[model samples]
Target chain A: MRNTQVIQVEGLTKKFGDFVAVDHISFEVEKGEIFGFLGANGAGKTTAMRMLTGLSKPSSGKGKVAGFDVLKESERIKERIGYMSQKFSLYEDLTVKENIRFYGGIYGLSKNQIRTKTSQILEELQLSEVGAKPVRSLPLGWKQRLAFAVSMVHEPEIVFLDEPTGGVDPNVRRQFWEAIYQASELGRTIFVTTHYMDEAEYCDRISIMVSGMIKALDSPDNLKKQF
Target chain B: MRRLRFLIQKEFIQIFRNKALLPMMTLLPIIQLIILSNAASNEVKDVRIAVVDHDQSEISRALSNKIMANDRFSLLAAPFNKKEALDLMQLDEVDIVLEVPPDFEKQLYRGEAPQLQTLVNAINGQQATVGSGYLNGIIATLNKEIRRNEPLFFSGLPKHNEPVVVTSNNWYNPELDYPHFMAPGILAELTALLTIVLTAMNTVREREIGTIEQINVTPIKKWEFILGKLVPFLCLGLVLLTVGLIASKLIFDIPIRGNIGLIFAYAVVNLICVLGFGLLISNFAETQQQAIFVAFFFVLIFVLMCGLFTPIDSMPKWAQYATIPNPLAHFISVSRKVLLKGSGLADIKMEFVYTFILALLFNAAAVWSYKKQE
Candidate 1:
């Protein structure tokens, strides 16, 4: 895995009318790095992720994500990045394989590519038996794992997981981390947001946001030493 | 284009997996087409009535027979007095009353005109008018017979000349079968109703479920996303339209005089407008229920103002102006022109233009509402 800047943010600011959700924050994520974004509820981590993912416009400032201009080439950036929302954003009515195929297809994967990727994803998660079952029928742990896998189906250069393991068991979270590590090994940048302090340890680097501003950003051990 | 195919595939999978919505998407239009087509007829028939006969003479019996023979009147009871007849009318058991005077046939032979009275329930004025005309026709026939051989009496009767005659040339619907006229309009209405509800609900559902955010993050363009959601419902609308057409033909035997292709062409344009309205509603609504409610309310108003049930000329000028963009109005006119009047495209160019422009305006509004970033 190469260490190159895949995402660069400079004074990115987002305001919703009067309230500032992400206030003039700046950051950069190197390729194949597990960049953990830590924040409390409403600390603007989701808002910032939204801007980086092109889901929301930055009120001001500038950024480039995956070598695409954030302002002018947001559509281009969108095509190359994957997003897994905090809400376990798989279609509940669709089967696991269907969700994978749908996301892969939307990312411009051909049928053969989706079929092959789906099988590989199912094999990796040991969820081959439930691939044909509806996502709604699966347990929360399985859903989180499936959502993570579905987000990477198109081999996007970067994957954004918003609190991806919100309500899963510890064993499932450990397994989910293994999948993220595997994605990093495959040269894909992993930008994850989580409230779990323990999950921050798995990242290559971590940023803690407080009240729409980054209070600390460094390796976990370095942050603990500073504290 | 690839993203669009994927989005459409996702929608189809979701629709197929959601067992409840699938049946409703396909079946509701057909069921409504069948039921509303029957219930929406304008022909007034089987009106209930009561007869108060005090004469008990052959003339009174003859009048009663004529009334009974008419398909429009159904005699509920023979009331003995005026009070009893009024009581039946008040109870809603009878819609009309035929009152016979106590004078026997001797009055007529004595060269005195016996009086007959018809009391009608006028709450529904159109039905009352039709009932009155039917009763008057029967009385005129009876009067002609009463003076059949009395040239002296007829000559002295102030020359009862029936002048200032009016004729109705019911061009399209000579028989005036209500189902035949209503079926086509109802089918057109189904296109509007189903297309709006399905497209609106589908888009709002995506927003609520957060799949829209996922898709937005993909390389998919805005047009791709919109078209992905739209094309499936358009196909569904066409399928429903075909089913409605089959129902009209097989069950009601409604005629198809003009080109079937032209009807479908108009339907496609009309679906674009309906779906555009749905997309606009989805963009404004925050929840699925809100989207459904708003769409339903607007569709109700559009249908009422479409001139399907009432004459557009009778509506106020302001109300007529409000219906200018209503696709149903144009579709209804086009439908009747084609199905009943056997009119070609040349005959309905204005209607076609109205529908086409309305479709374009709605689509432009929808595209404008779909924001790329929020």
Candidate 2:
């Protein structure tokens, strides 16, 4: 189990010109685990996620994702992992299938792989009927699901979801979690950040961060008992 | 390389998918090239002249007739005095007032160099300069007629009166067809404007929409990313150049003396240079509005100094030196030389070298300033 660690952080810190966004923190996540990074507003969840996803550099600390140093080998880290931003970053003007093909292509996926997976993903998401429509025409829940599906089109080793379930109906959030659990079951690591305590309850393990430092790290039942 | 192709494909799709920007990009150059090119020329034509024929002599009439005979000037009125002529000029009714002094014919008969008073509205300094040149041309032609018509029998001077006629062949643009020169220059301008505005705004839009964050997380290299943004716009730029060339050839009758293939080749280098500069500005701008303002700031300065409207020779030494690295300046010089003058690559080797160097520097700056994060 120790050898199965997919992410390892030791004293990871980040600074933005005198503002400590992510203070010294340490954590680990094993393979095939749903690890929830819980934090309140301005708790540095996003800043931490940015550093882990290679979209930002950590300041004065050590961080690793998928056995690659966060600072030095960000390019390699990018190739091996997936990231779905909270902003719904997929192109709304592009059709659902086009958006899928675009992401898959950028990840160096072949035409055949893209074509075959396009139908598979659309069918699985029950979005086959609307796959040819522009993503802008879809409801927020559908767009959110489609964005997540596009992020994983390249079959990354680990998929980092930054507040993936933000601002969605409870039912949709539940459905989104089901997809996360399914990905975890397939031995793909999931590193998700969320503000919902209930979502944290569904994680295999949870680490609560406050003021750039981790205050708790345990399973849901253990944390509840300790609290 | 494969990832680069994909990124380029994504960019092309996004660009073509943009309903608002696509129409503007396609229409602006067409309208500006067709409408503005004709309006952007320096050749002085159709000057209204108010002639004050005080002498009312054959020589004064011959001079007025010569000014009118040359299709460049029109005599609106033959005023009795210079005051009415001056009034006409002040009212903007005439561009020049030609007052033939009373001794105009008598002075020539007496072998004295009589003064022909000429007043020109020098409001538009270039217009005034050209108008004055035309005035000098009329006077010189009359002087030649006087020299030839003067009888050698008077024995006023020696046989050295053989007229030293300065036959100026306005070569290349013999008729001084302002349109022929303006068409290609405007095309160069259209290319520069379209590529700059498109590349700058497109990159910044991605940042505004937060798509840049998603792209930054990709495994794509920085050079690949910048090239991805540039290649689509470059292809579109080529399309624009071709259309402009065709329009210039068909509508304006602009001669294509140089090799069309050579034109395309240099346009590639020129497009790369302009696009690279645009991308460099985009890399520094944090928002789409900022990108537009900054891009316009540089584009305005570069285009204005590129000799599109003003002659390069007329610019001061410092301004000419400043235009040395301006890619639009290089492109305009190359396009005009190639299209109008039939100049080959050998003739424009220096321009190509400068553009190539500018392309290298601008692309390098664009890549360097592009922060992969934040």
Q: Tens digits of per-residue lDDT for model 2 on B224-300?
A: 89999889999989988887788778888899999889889999998999999989989988898999999989888
Fraction of native contacts (fnat) of each candidate: 0.90, 0.77
Report the CAPRI category for model 2. Answer: medium
lDDT of 1 at B195: 84
lDDT of 1 by residue, A1-227 (tens): 32379999999999999999999898899988899999999999999999999889999999999998787789888878888998768889888888888888787788899889999989988889998998899999888888888888887899999998888889989988998998899999999999999999999999999989999999999999999
Global fold similarity of model 1 (TM-score):
0.89
lDDT agreement of model 1 with the native: 0.85
Question: Candidate 1, residues B242-326: lDDT per residue as tens digits?
Answer: 8888878988899998888888888888888788889989989889999989998998888999988887888999999888888
Report how far residue B154 has shifted in candidate 1, in Å: 0.4
How high a TM-score does candidate 2 get? 0.93
Best by DockQ: 1
TM-score of chain B of 2: 0.93
